[model samples]
Target: MRVVKAPDVRRSEILAAANQLFQTQGYSRTSVDQIVNKVRIAKGTFYHYFKSKEQILDALADQLVLDMAYHSEQIANHTQLNAIEKIVTIISEQNRLQSEQQNVVDSMHLPDNRQLHERINIKIVLTFGPILATVIEQGNQQGLFDVKDPLSTIQFILAGSLFLFGEGVFNWPPEQAQARIQSMIILIERTFGAQPGSMIIALNQCLNEEKR
Candidate 1:
């Protein structure tokens, strides 16, 4: 008897196969046939779910962004956490996800993948901006943050961080990079009207926990 998988399950299988191939063989060299073969699926089956190889790449990026957004939204909705705690939780989860996907991140940074890299960055901002904005707005209402526009502020922070910290955008020496990161953190605190060291301290604790 032939087995028929559910649509979502089958699509996930295809994506998992493509992700592995992309990681091991590089996206530029991975073909649709390779992905289908890896998943033991027909070319028609792959095309049924995704229009093109580029779309598969986009789907992969969507999955990553959605995963991060889900985590952020969950934290944002938690009634027990204040705005600062929510922000710290969201960042910590985002960092953990990014670190887990570091290889994929590095692959996207390759010069040939610049277009896809840019698309992924935009997707992140679009998906996460609103989720983050709500948290910031909550902060504003609670007097934890003073922002005229929460969504705009979040988008700006996301875009600037992506640009400044994106791989190959700038190559700074170790000390310079550290200084710039410090400056960015301080700027973020000021932007939110947060206490001078509160965000810095919270972020440092988050990072230290990640390291452990």
Candidate 2:
């Protein structure tokens, strides 16, 4: 009988190594040979787990979107915060996640895997819908926000916040990324028909001193 180890554990280890290597070098520069060598796995074993380097990078993107979902869920659980406060929380959380993903992307050429990138982008956008729905429901119930279509509104906000990252259209200074995100949050809040002053104040309080 063969002893069995958890597939996910081994896969997670492989992905961790890939992330590290891909960051230091780059995605395009990272070959499967190096990854298996670094992971101390045989070439056959590597194929057993992943079909190609693109698959691995796709896995990386999927992991990030899952992480974003996890973090946003955590923020949603902070019921102590009000609806507006939750918007701020959501903004900071997504921006924080984007920065980390960008660092990983910087070390890799993920755009070459355009399909995977688009899939992961959809994953992130889909993950955000629930939280926004909750906020929209709460705000409308409280008469603090007006919305005709919660789903469409959520989609718009998600697109506005993350469109640039998905398309690689915008890049901001490291010191200013948070600020730019906050600015987008302000735009989203206003577009959703929330009072900018209270929402902005709430968002500013959520950001670190440096970001504010």
Candidate 3:
């Protein structure tokens, strides 16, 4: 007897196959036929789940944001770590993922990919802001942060950190990037009323670990 897969399960299988192909073959080189062939699904089935290759890319971007949020939430939920530690862990994880996926990052630097890159960034901030805000709210309760609005504060931080320091934007020198990072830390600390230099220490520690 053969079994039937649920719609959502089938959709995820398609996404999984597409993600693997996109990572291995490059997104622009991968096609609908390849994705369906990998999954042994009909072309029509792929269209049922996604209208086009671009739509699959959009879904992949959404998955990336959700995966990041899920990991950040896990750090935020850790009982032993304070709010600052959770934030640091989240940042560190993000940096680690970025390093691991440098190919994906570099693809976004292509001139033709600018629109898709911008769309992905918007999706990331929309999905990630609330998760970060939860951490900020916890900080407020613990008296580590004194911001009146966690959501808005997170949005502002993400705008600068995501767009300004993000790849393919300013193309800053190493020294300039470091300076901007330091300034961002200071801005975040001051805006939320966190202790001076604490965020800097955390960021430095994360960067140091990335070297090893």
User: Cα lDDT of all candidates, in order?
Assistant: 0.84, 0.70, 0.79
lDDT of 3: 0.79
Clashing pairs for model 1 are: none
Off by over 4 Å in 1: 21-34, 51-54, 204-212
TM-score to true structure, per model: 0.85, 0.77, 0.83
Worst 10 residues of 2 by lDDT: 203-212
**Candidate 1 local Cα displacement, residue 109, angstroms:** 1.8
What are the runs in model 2 whose C-alpha is more than 4 Å off?
A: 1-4, 107-110, 164-167, 170-187, 201-212
Which ranges of candidate 3 are over 4 A from the true structure? Answer: 1-4, 97-109, 205-212
Total backbone collisions for each predicted model = 0, 2, 0
Best by TM-score: 1
**Model 3 Cα lDDT, one tens digit per residue, 1-212:** 53468999999999889878878878779889999899998898889889988777767766666777788878878889878998899989877776665446556656777887888788777877888898899899999999899998898888767777666778788888777777777888899899887677887777545433
* Ranking of models by lDDT: 1, 3, 2
